[model samples]
Target chain A: MGFWKTWFSTPESVSATKSAAFEEHTASTGDPSANSDRIVFSTERDIDLYELEELCDAVGWSRRPLRKVKKAIEHSFLVASMWQVRGNQRRLIGFARATSDHAFNATIWDVVVHPDFQGKGLGKALMKYVLKKLRSEEISNVTLFADPHVVDFYRTMGFMSDPEGIKGMFWYPH
Target chain B: MGFWKTWFSTPESVSATKSAAFEEHTASTGDPSANSDRIVFSTERDIDLYELEELCDAVGWSRRPLRKVKKAIEHSFLVASMWQVRGNQRRLIGFARATSDHAFNATIWDVVVHPDFQGKGLGKALMKYVLKKLRSEEISNVTLFADPHVVDFYRTMGFMSDPEGIKGMFWYPH
Candidate 1:
């Protein structure tokens, strides 16, 4: 079987989870349709997705299956999501994730800003959301990485060079 | 189609492997015979097997035969293997893994201590090996999940409480 057909042809999707999470993050200063150089913040509760490949292709997000997408959603829930919007349109502009036990710890992952909207301070805005939740929840420390040049951005957010931090690696199946 | 047959019976078993590797480490100062306290740390390069299922069941590590292991191994440059030993002799005590980029970033995985040696700090000793190597190489960061009560152990090792740091979810295909 072909790669696409073999991996993504299944009709069974993790759709319609129907969570009441909207009650948690009801604060947003901007609107999805508001026209400006501004962005909107919202916490979607239930996301029904079927064609991850098609959706990711359309929006230029990485095309992965249910597993990766679910990880993205779960990570976003632990932190909060900030959308870079022009007017009513929204895209996954900048994001930071958290791994939390809700009592005394949380870790951050995949903090990214869309290349099209990088210098506009969207990253700062997204970090703002992550930091607010982490600090208020008594999650004293938040950690992450930077691509050498962007190290300054994290430093501005109160993260310093953790010369002794842990390590991350990737392996290919070839 | 039987489980064992499908598992252990491989036609190319004899000559397929490129080579076998056995590196050395200072076994934990704790009781070496305590089966549950022992953990094994190996790299993909160290593993000589091709079939993923065999690696999965090698030492009873809970993992799926996904591209993740392949990626980790590739990133690790074949320095990885599954550990399985009985006692005292410490014949590869248990199974540990890496998430490597083949060149730099790689996070170790599983790190199963044999059933009989649960709380003897063997697992921690194995992690010490991975951390030391990554740190010496000045790696990006390492990530993994410890069993809740063990979070403090990881924290002491400088892993931020970002369980959400590298969150993942799955829905297996039928």
Candidate 2:
């Protein structure tokens, strides 16, 4: 509902949602504490490959060891979309990840907000960032799954019922 | 529909889809002249991890090396609803991985037919394989997002229409 801010200063960062992702070897890390705390707006960063693994671990998304994380970083940058409010480096408040051409469209999967940071409008703000990035790159479509409980939120964001009315699918190799 | 023969024979494969992949790395020597025509499904021992990689490469789905492949295999086995088909020494043909607890089910992904031996009914055969596995598991609810062009094929296979259509979503963290 409000204007979105750019994650990084570089123009390449604007349209490049996960550049290393398509190429395969990626590590994402971000400065979650940049803003530290301001409900209106905050600073965000790219969670490079290595940093992403740590965040995933902190959040218990995947039980991968640091060794594997190290090896994975060498191969493909982990593609994940994340946001930190008030610069909480100790935690990743809201996050998501998807694979895409960036120019065509984006698939937004796993929109999660940290337990302590929920209901503060951080999730929306982060997604707005993602949608804005995708749109800037000429991506007209931004798709995601809304847990039935929160379908209204996504609906407000412009996602509609699929022609089949079925929830989108996701798979975690790990 | 013709009856599909999907047998999950406990063939003793030397390389089982385990939880630890990279640790089980093996050297690869591609059969450059491998009968790129008809792949003779050999025993598990005959098809080392490397051979699996080769077959996956030749087919085009993906062979995420030992590390990543191990996780996928574990996930496949862990989910009470996996219909795996492995061949003799270094010979693996059609495969379809599904995730479900046997009640509400969805196969988020899979169908890796070796490229060299496609168009010979392997993909369809694999789908049949998946169907049989699901039915036997007593899983009546199976869902997935078939490409627009392929929706008809799924309908022909007995998958009903999606009353509420949904598209998958993703957003990579950078």
TM-score of each: 0.40, 0.39
Worst 10 residues of 2 chain B by lDDT: B19-28
- The candidate 1 chain B region of ten consecutive residues with least summed lDDT is B14-23
DockQ score for candidate 1: 0.06
lDDT of 1 by residue, A57-156 (tens): 5546564456545644543425344444345454545455554434333456556566655565556766766666567565543544445666677767
Distance (Å) between predicted and true CA of B71, model 1? 33
Every model: Cα RMSD to truth: 13.4, 14.3
- Give the least accurate 10-residue stretch of model 2 chain A, judged by summed lDDT: A20-29
User: Candidate 2 residues B15-86, lDDT tens each?
Assistant: 232211112111111334433222222112222346456656775644454754444444441121111223
Show model 2 residue runs off by greater than 4 Å: A1-36, A39-91, A102-105, A164-174, B1-144, B147-174
TM-score quality measure for candidate 2: 0.39
lDDT of each: 0.44, 0.42
Clashes of each: 45, 56
Residues A1-174, candidate 2, lDDT per residue (tens digit)? Answer: 111345344346544533322111111223354323333222233334455555555556755455543332232211334433344333345556432322333445445666555565556656666565556555444555555666767766666655443334332111
